[model samples]
Target: MSTRTETDSMGAIEVPSKAYWGAQTQRSKENFAIGHQPMPLAVVHALAHIKKAAARVNANLGELPTDIAQLIEQAADEVIAGELDQHFPLTVWQTGSGTQTNMNVNEVIAGRANEISGQTRGGKSPVHPNDHVNRAQSSNDCFPTAMHIAVLQAVTLHLTPAIKTLRDGIDQQAKRYEKLVKTGRTHMMDATPVTFGQELSAFVAQLDYAQTAIDNSLPAVCELAQGGTAVGTGLNSSPGFAEAIAKELAQLTELPLRSAPNKFAALAGHEPLVTLSGAIKTLAVTLMKLANDLRLLGSGPRAGLAEVHLPANEPGSSIMPGKVNPTQCEALSMLACQVIGNDTTISIAASQGHLQLNVFKPVIVHNLLESIELLADGCVNFQKQCIAGMTANEQQMAAHLENGLMLVTALNRHIGYDNAAKIAKKAYEDNQTLRQAALDLGLVTDEQFSQWVRPEDMLQPE
Candidate 1:
């Protein structure tokens, strides 16, 4: 490939001729060959938004030239539109402060701006990367600000809607099964009779609670640390720069973003992200339980619970001739596990902010974004592929309900607990029905037994 020399404070390096990144970006790309996981494009696009907002703010403050600022704004627009995606090639494992990725964005925007002004890409002549593109900011402030923007937008635009879609789908299924009674289980054993609708409603409630928790954590995430340049002192930044830039960003992204009240706390720690991750983790736990319950209820067509039938999306085993599997449930459960694990990583990373900055920004944002995307995509798939097509096995549920010894629970108030226990034990040990057992035990007459032991009557309170 053709190459061109680009210069930074360190020195000059040979960058690909077609690449828009400068020397620092090239150095980072070459220096950190750690892993294949590139910095999230969401973060890169967020950085572009920051740069665009910063340019407009800087020009309004008369700190930057208008022509130069306009060029930078246009370049930033391209980046935000994903037109310059290939230019940001830094890995997440580079600098702890995400300085490299920040500079990568700066270099790309500068190069593209220069090109727009009929200048070459390598040198920062018409639009210097640091002075023009990144005027009132440091990587410390810019990266965290970008992290917050990316996470907030993703959760609101993607995850929230996906959760609601799945929740609504499950709710429709619940209504359809409202009158379909089935045997309820506790401790993996039969307990009593319950309507299938009531059981599924529990999952709906869990998702509702989880979505509320996630929504509550967002106001804190909306607080941006943009003006806390370097050590949160706002050293080179002009007065009102923080608030002005926040206004610009809010206008650009259509979010309720505002400058953080305490720039020190915003830069030095990541409490908001930790709180959000905890909420997401709670959601993961809820999804895990829901998926597991569905898997168990839909376990077997012949030998297992078979109380509900999951959509047969794929074959269960490679060699099995006629086995269908709960693949969507398994997939959703696995995604939940991954999100739960990501929460642990985010928590530990959030705690490691030593002095005036949390150096673990990249990893924290990477994991958080990954969890959000996984959950959003997983919910959509589970809803469309599994929950949408799911059907209740009423015949199997009714048979199980009739065979359950726990139905004897209904006889307690009439015959007393001791008598009820005696009838249940006799029915199990002697292989007799509850009615026959009650007759032989002489607990109640046939007419009374019929009145006292109805499964449908046991569904609600007496």
Candidate 2:
């Protein structure tokens, strides 16, 4: 885009004659055919933050003479406000060099700046967009900074709120269904009695711990590598410029942002990215566990243990009529698996950061942003479809609890272990109820038996 105002002589169908990203966009379109899910919104947020910070910095310095800087700022504001999306063109796929993306941002900003100045589309003269606006910055620092800023922004804006909604729904259910008895299962077999609320409360605990795990990493998330320049040496940056720029970014983003203590380490490796990715993977683990529970609880209306019912999203099958599937639960499980896999990609990519800079940024951002987006979307859907609509089947729960062989646990408290074993075995063989067999053998008096068989007492142990 910083080149000429035209497309590559040989690339995709000509959609528009105007050019800013110039031949790079055309070349990218022709080369990488990766599907368009759109660049991550975190990436968008980051770019906007860059524009805002630049404009504010220029304002503070009051030295930028041309109207171009101000105009580029306005265009960036439009992009942030959800307008002019077509203009932010660049393929998600490119060579690891990031030339296409850097040029893409540079040209778009420069051209829009030119437009504001009533100049030609490809002109950068009056303000020299890259020189004046992107002054003292490098793609290496900006992209990684954007990645951190974007992730932190999402955790604050979207992920945290969604997780709260999810946790609150389950927490309410835990309290609401605390009195409802259900058959607890382990290894796909009925184990003992438990309150349906208690089982749900376990998931609530998982969500809480996961929330804590993510929240605990906020400090690391806030630390940034903005001053790292091309290789973290603070190369052309002035003394305190890094700090001032970081402060400007913090003000613009409203995040607790800071410059990294060791710019060298920040640039030479991506350990922080790997750590954050692991945190995200931990969240996926929590979600997968929650989804598995919901799926199991909603397993069957007929043959399976239907302890809780989930809202039917659609006709479960085209061929099998009258069957409903746990679509939301399934989606969450799938997303969790994908996120876990994304973390692996992130880990590998971050670890492979060669000597000075990592060429793996595009891939790292791709995986990290995608993982976060899925997490946000999945949590919102899971809360709405699965958790909100889930209902405790009190009758089914009571029946399962009453009919299970786990009631033998109560017999052990009343009679000796040997006597309880004998009673359970005889009841199994005789096809008689534990109470009936107990009465026949006098292992428990009828009054004692009537007093001791409370499921609540069995689960809570007094």
Query: Local distance difference test, per candidate?
Result: 0.93, 0.74
Q: Give the total clashing residue pairs for model 1.
A: 0
TM-score of 2: 0.90
Output the lDDT of residue 405, model 1.
93
Q: Residue 358's C-alpha lDDT in candidate 2? A: 76
Compare the candidates by lDDT and give the number of the best one: 1
What value does the lDDT take at residue 187 in candidate 2? Answer: 89
Query: Using Cα atoms with residue i matched to residue i, what is each candidate's TM-score against the true structure?
Result: 0.99, 0.90
lDDT string, candidate 1, 1-462, tens digits:
999999888988899999999999999999999999999999999999999999999999999999999999999999999998988888899888999999999999999999999988756989999999989899999999999999999999999999999999999999999999899999999999999999999999999999999999999999999999998988789999999999999999999999999998888899999999999988899889989999999998898999888998877888989889888889999999999999999999999998898899999999999999999998898899999999999999998988899999988888789999999999999998888999999989999988888878888888
